[model samples]
Target: MELHELESAWKTLDAQVAQQDVELKQLRTQNLRMRMRGKLMRASFGQWAQLGIGLLFALWGGSYWFDHLGTPHLVAYGLAVHAYGIALLATAVVMLLHLAAVDYAQPVADVQQRLLTLRRTRIRSERVCWIVGAVVWVPIMMIALRTIGLDAWLANPAWVLGNLAAAVAIAAAAAWVMWRRPAWFAKLSMDGPLAEVERQLADISELRA
Candidate 1:
């Protein structure tokens, strides 16, 4: 009887979760519709955050570009610096283009299922984009490093140390986000939204008997 009672309680909990999931989905759709209808709202801070990052990169690239202007060795270090600067500009442009193309107002339920069934397939497409970007830009970084050479003045304590530190910080940030917000990239468990739907199924099962 204890086992049966425990099962009964679980079934009830499952049903409640399912109802909540359905409600959440409906609210999401309505929010999207509002967005597409030009009633979509973004937090004021989000806009400022985007603008601030863009402004910072702009200032950084500008300073980096201006500092290296009309250098003695145009083909060697100068060319590489220009190329690296261009890469930063290109990345910024691509990011903006991607932002422009995305229609976040459309809510697709299939996203959840797609994450499960097409992980490899989706990754292949994603990797292709990365590969193309790398093919174009990795050579630029390599050329820049080669041009500057390992023993150059700027390459010594300032530039090299800065690059390594930036790389480490990026890796740490990625790891932290992956751990704290696993669902942001991949589903951690079906227990979240799916389990509730299962409870609803259990309730229906009881009604049938």
Candidate 2:
């Protein structure tokens, strides 16, 4: 759907998140263990979903990568095809978040210490991404620079830049998704009540503070 529509859907969920917050507080007072377990379930569920998404995309991307362009595809063509891999790879990344705004409402389904724990875990995941970028992306970047050099790479570096740019955009979008609906980020990227979900998520967050 369109961005604004996504935002609106997100808003509805945001309200739910706030409502969940109150429910969680009540659960804490009513059933401490259930509340904690609920959090654990939510966290585990999110991670599992994200792992599945990433694996699916990467595998699909790999298939697309080796799917074959033609009887004699050049390196450029290969790279272009591989750009799909990058996009899929980006989709696979699951930001550490446990909000149920997107996840439970439509198809699937967290708590406070649980929220905090999930947040901490999410932070670590981002760090891991950063680390992975350094270990994997940097070497490739250096090679890119060497091959294309300062001038050539700079001039119409669409091939090199497209992957990086897509990655950056995906990362930013994923980050936002995680904050608002970690489960949604894990399950789906392009869709997932983004418009309403975002609006609700914003309101939920605002309500919290």
Candidate 3:
């Protein structure tokens, strides 16, 4: 072959190879995005389920509180439960909003940042709910007893007080533990879908780099 013709052929091959590389990267990115979409869908479903449950709790608590409006202790118990339900609803809403805010079309770094924010919010909310649940159960139990036609507080004020004290102690201890050893709880938070998404994002970023 002529030298000039040979050089032209070589340049054509190089261009083809570069095009294939671009196409391959695009394919890999698309596949990663599909996987990420599936993960986000699953996470969204979970949040929707939580939202439904929160709504149910709020409805029940609201009705209970309304019914016991004339009784101070029962009203207090009902209000506490109602507030817990509201908190749950709020958490669900916030999480769903964060999920919605995640734009897959953006760069991987941006998506990862949003996912991390969601994960952080989720972990903090879960911690709050776990600690508060310890004390919230007292009110729940009181409401349950009331449902069965028993005024627990009136029948055994000392018992009720004791239970309240124990719950407070438990909640306080849990809070202290979480505050002192945050890394322990952080490990626990690293298992969810958001964490998985973050991991995959890191891998994708590394591959692209």
Candidate 4:
């Protein structure tokens, strides 16, 4: 081949390589955006479903309680039950609202920060649920005692102690699942989505560096 022809061919090859690099980068950016959007959508849908179910359950229970106002069956812990229901509904709404604010349009770092904030919020909400459960459990025990009669409850110290032990065990199990378990559903659904986003963010940081 002539020298001029060789030089022209090399220039063409370099230009093609540059073009492909640009196209590849563009494709990667598009893919990342799509993935983040999908993650946000899934998280939002899950939160919305939770909120809808919780709201329906709370309303249904509240209506039943109202309908049976002053009934003997609910007389002992009716107020407590209503309180617990309201607390549950409030937590669900808060979670839904927080998830709603999770915007994927932002930069990768911003999105990761938002997701981390959400994780913290979820942890706090779980703790709140535990506290509310304990609060409601007391009223439940009160109802149980009333139903069995105070005399019978006093006569069965072993049963009372057993029930207390069971409650403590259940609470401990829940705490373990929330804080220690590696494959919790909330982590899978919520944190799992952000894993890709975090990877992209790290990639971006490296590129910037």
For lDDT, the strongest prediction is 3
TM-scores vs. true structure, each candidate: 0.29, 0.32, 0.90, 0.62
lDDT tens string, model 4, 1-209? 99999999999999999999878776777676677668756766766765665566466556656765766445335555666667667777777676677665676667667767877666676666775575457546655575566633446757755765776777777777667774564555345555565566566555434
Model 3 earns a TM-score of 0.90
Q: Which ten residues in a row have the lowest lDDT in candidate 1?
A: 36-45
- Each prediction's Cα RMSD? 13.1, 18.1, 1.9, 5.5
Better of 3 and 4 by TM-score: 3
**TM-score head-to-head 1 vs 2, winner:** 2
Predicted candidate 3, C-alpha RMSD:
1.9
Candidate 4's C-alpha runs over 4 A off are 1-12, 64-76, 130-165, 176-209
Q: Which run of 10 residues does model 4 get worst, by summed lDDT?
A: 72-81
Q: Give model 4's TM-score versus the native structure.
A: 0.62
Which candidate should be chosen as best, given TM-score against the real structure? Answer: 3
Q: lDDT by residue for model 3 over 81-182, one digit each (tens)?
A: 788888788988998999999998999888888988987888888787777789889999988887799989999999999999999999999888889998
lDDT of 2 by residue, 1-209 (tens): 99999999999999999899888754543443334335545555655675665555446434543654452322333343344435434433433334432232221113334344445445555544543343335324533464455433445556656766766776566566667875654434312332233333334444445
TM-score of 2: 0.32
Which portions of model 3 show Cα errors greater than 4 Å? 2-7
TM-score of 1: 0.29
